[model samples]
Target: MSDSYPQSALREWRAHMGHPATLVAILGVGLVLGVAGPFGTDVRLTLLPRIAYWLITVLLTYSAGTLCDAMLKRPLARFGFWVHLAVTALATGVAILLVLLVVNYIVYGWLPDRDSLPAFLGTNFAIAIIVSVVLATVHRQSTPVEIVSNPVRILDRLPLDKRGPLVALSVEDHYVRVQTTRAEDLILMRLSDAIAEVGDTKGAQVHRSHWAAFEHVTTARREGDRAILTMNTGTDIPVSRANVAKIKEAGLLP
Candidate 1:
């Protein structure tokens, strides 16, 4: 589960708060709050306790929200927008509340009472909901970018310079040929293993011997009853008859 969770969380993060601009915005907010201090109290025994506190809180909250987003994605996809938002809010709220409790205890030795816990939880919930909504909007407005920018677990077998936006993977005897935008390399791994390593990159096995990244597909054409995908690098990949319908439903085929 741990192996799959990070990949799932990474995909969700890219879908929402993974943009470079969103990261800049988060850092900017952290800087403002750090200097200003909560409730305008800047008194500190240490050199930068306020700044540290603010930055830590921002990191924790965002991490919790991203994790919850990944965990709830599949289950919530079947529901309406409002239901997704509600579940996300509730889960993120609980995560934030727990994070705040730990952070407060560490930074100020403060613990909430039964009476005070409700108010604290409510405040954290409100903040989480707002952040989630704002980030979701930003994600919607931004242009779709490469989802494979992060280092892939499977690509570690290839040379460092060859790791780039994966174009496709083809089985060659006992080895798999990994084609990235930058370069192509052969690895002594089975196609099935390679596919599992591809993680969250949007792709499907178009043929028994071929899997192509959707983003790298430049054109989709039909050759008789079979489907063909022309990659950006000009490699034409054949799509098996059995997988043609699945690729069409994914909008990778016409």
Candidate 2:
């Protein structure tokens, strides 16, 4: 999968964390919350301290959420949404509450009263469920690669972002580097089997280990008895003498 596209729950969360936009989001949301000072934080602390408080709290919760998502995946992968939400809320709520105990102590100089512990836990659970649902929704947005006429079996092996119109395929040991208009991916499949899955795409195996789509062949030039085909992606594929006729027949060469 592309690092940008959302995938499995944990992986998707991790990928998002690596994006620059995620940092922007974290900083923006922290600033807003600090200014607004939810739960009386604005009243309790000065402006700079308020911003610092929310910023560190935001950072802690984000780290806790990532950890909780990973920990809960194995147990919840087979479960449905309600079960996931309830369990996720509990797990993440507990994890964050533990860390927040220290944060609260540092900010306020003491924890909430023992009698108010349940209320604190409840607040954590509510926040956890909201964050869980949003992350789950992001994870669900990934679309699987679809292939062939009915569905190409080989294209399914490529990542979602790499699934586009056919370009070329090249063999590298046990793997075939499948290229589409969008990008290329190395799939663990034979060149022959990959070509069989080309379906409606008009292309030919121009070399013993290379295949080129006719529509994507940008230049075809004769090289003595053999030929060279340059694809739209600027990949030059050497066409063996035996396949020269096929390339010519496809009008890839004059």
Candidate 3:
């Protein structure tokens, strides 16, 4: 069950993080909030400050949870990526409040009630979801770039200069479309099996259909609450909560 798609899902998320669109998304959220306010109340709510805060806090906490998954499967796996997301959301909410309280107490000598935690986190959660989803959707639509000419490098026995690599070796539907260099070739192997085979190759499976090479990863992007990785091939992959940390610790992320 673990091999089915969670690994590949993790790989895909890592790939979406680098897209310019992802940044635009974060900015767009800020832009909208800057104009409308955090809750979009008629007055200036100014969600940008909170948005920025949670973006950093959430991604860090979420990635940390994902890294834990890399070592062992937990009851958390049963809920799939959503569980990681929930924890991230909760952690971000708590972290933000803690920061605000500490700063306020030190500077202003005031602290809000802990009972208000729900309202505080809820507002930020809504904003994060909105921005993150937009980026994730944009990222999902991008095509994956494949390295076909370099197939020889992937083959264990042959030198890249010697023989042409075999074509049609594997084909798995990918969340990120791949375009091989010499010619586009669909990897004929099962998505799960392919990732397992390359487990030692400095890569992670991000989704059922996405497998990103570690050397090919360029940056990590966050769309509101979701995380994506931008690959060297210029493709975005979705990162499942279950495998986020594994891919990160593998040094697949920047």
Candidate 4:
């Protein structure tokens, strides 16, 4: 049985996919292409080659999904994690097949003229299922790294190793959440200065008190007067009214 975790765990998955908006965009484009393929000239290919092509597409999508899942130590703890993963995987497969269909249509006039529509759909769905299963298994097999904390490096010292990666620090009550590796580290420091010191990682202060890793933010949601950033960890970080414009200008918002 799978263990339970918070919704925040999905942050990494969402972020790695380039966010929900990106996936939706990919799917929309795929749908348009899939329908257009039937009129393409390459429709003469036999059933066997078409099957092979779809299988290849599944493999590619599976690889991409597995790569994304590998980034998280544990899978996202949601009510329907497996279901969601399966859907996302199949959707990704469809998007890929649609792209191929569109390509065939543009280059040629008809696609799979030798085969029926039912056969193509059947083949694509079957391959999607297989790829999704393989990708999920691969994700389950990934090894997770253990992180240890060092409490000695408090604000008492001036700072010794300033040359290393700039760790953007923020104190969240008792814990200091350091935004790095798209993972958070509990440390002790003020958030204000931490954002200024983080040199290598490109990010910004989405909130008056919150510092966000630019690359880590997958999507931004506008909730009334407030803006929330869905981070790599899936936790929503509020974007202060003052910083909303700047974050939008940075292209962090959809």
Candidate 5:
């Protein structure tokens, strides 16, 4: 069960990296670079050896870059597109450069001298930015863009990463706990105010301190004088006596 947000992220990461097109693209890049034999490899080695070098370099660099990108992309999403792109690119660039350095060292048996380091690093960083822009665009296109256009004013209270279908809400002192399908976070607002901001989403304040979306209500059972409504997120919210009929009217329970 995806009770954990981190587990949800891990599953998405696996699906993205293991896609058949991604695998083919990796192979295609390696093959194209192998044939091109850039960076003096054509002069230094025979055709087959040069091809192998490019293939290995591309494979190693892509592996490092993709892993770094996956790790940072979600966390940085809150920062907006440009900031996220710059940060992820720099980080993923460093990872790719380090792997590229190792692979290049194996081929030439030498490291860059101090004088050439600046140019070498600058070239790699520039390349990294271009790669990052492409990646960021692809991801942006694939991601659903509902939050910006959504009529629900309450969604504005959540970070981009935590925003999704509403599950439940609760008051903890001064903070209102907003639980969405993707992740949950607390906003400093009264329970009543939060419920008001829910806008068009079909939901109700189940208790004085709790709110639950109608579609997200999964199970309900009577406990003593009150009823407990189970949300799809596995949270059991205590229903007040006053709202018990309201819950029954929603067809969530008999």
Candidate 6:
């Protein structure tokens, strides 16, 4: 069950990080760095080597940061906003440093001697923090637009303008109440079927009567042996004892 946390977090991370615009931005930075040279290295290298170096470095750093983001999400969230930022910045910095070390060794046969590794790590680590902070800011600004453009298929039952990012679904007798960021409405359907139709939206049945989208969850709190998901809309949805492990594995609880 614990093993599933990383996988689920990684899936969620990929969903956000795989945006075409993000890829294009990373690629553009790499191209510019390659052409202009990083730390005056391009002046000594040919066009092909310079391009390859920057491209590989950017790709590796991006991948490492994504993985670190997934792994550190829950712990950082539990630690609160400021701590989350600091921890993520530090972890991403170390990851980028390591990636650069390996990439440089492979590409340029430049193995840092033991005496030089500390300075190399420090320099790359600083670069990593700056890059990660910038990327995070960009993603935050672009995310709302992306969410608005990509409508969820499961929300087709709602009116055109009413549909938004899904929040939660509650089963009320024979009908399922669909909650979105914009509003809530009832549609005749079983919770199980609704869960199936939700498709790629990351969510889980927290209780027999309730299903909550991971993205819409603002917090998760424990009550005795059960868990409760506090959604973005400020509604608290209860989690059954049976689903506690499932919710934890989804990284919805810390």
**Which residue runs of candidate 2 sit more than 4 Å off their true CA positions?**
1-15, 80-82, 141-254
Per-model CA lDDT versus the true structure: 0.71, 0.72, 0.44, 0.50, 0.73, 0.72
Please identify model 1 stretches exceeding 4 Å from their true place. Answer: 1-6, 11-19, 40-47, 137-238, 242-254
TM-score pick, better of 2 and 5: 5
Using lDDT as the yardstick, the better of models 4 and 5 is 5
Lowest lDDT sum, 10 consecutive residues, model 5, at: 1-10
Error of 5 at 251 (Å): 12
Q: What TM-score, over all chains together, does every model reach?
A: 0.53, 0.50, 0.31, 0.34, 0.55, 0.56
Q: Summing lDDT over every window of 10 consecutive residues in candidate 4, give the lowest-scoring window.
A: 154-163
Which 10-residue span in candidate 1 carries the lowest summed lDDT?
A: 138-147
Q: The CA-based lDDT of model 4 is what?
A: 0.50
- Shift of residue 236 alpha carbon in model 3, Å: 21
On lDDT, the candidate that comes out on top is 5
Per-residue lDDT, model 1, residue 99, is 93
Cα deviation in Å at residue 231, candidate 3? 13
Q: Quick one: how many clashes does candidate 5 have? A: 0
Write one digit per residue (lDDT tens) for candidate 4, span 50-71.
Answer: 4444444333454355343333
Off by over 4 Å in 3: 1-18, 39-118, 121-254
Q: What would the per-residue lDDT of candidate 3 be over residues 24-66, giving only the tens digit for each residue?
A: 5555655554454333232322355545543444444434333
- Model 5 deviation from the true structure expressed as Cα RMSD, one decimal place: 7.8
Candidate 4: misplaced stretches above 4 Å?
1-169
lDDT (tens digit, per residue) of candidate 6 on 47-126:
87898789878877888897786576555544544565678878899888888778777777887899987887778788
RMSD of each: 12.9, 10.3, 15.5, 14.4, 7.8, 12.3
Q: What is the Cα-based lDDT of residue 155 in candidate 3? A: 40
Which residue pairs does candidate 6 place in steric collision? Answer: none
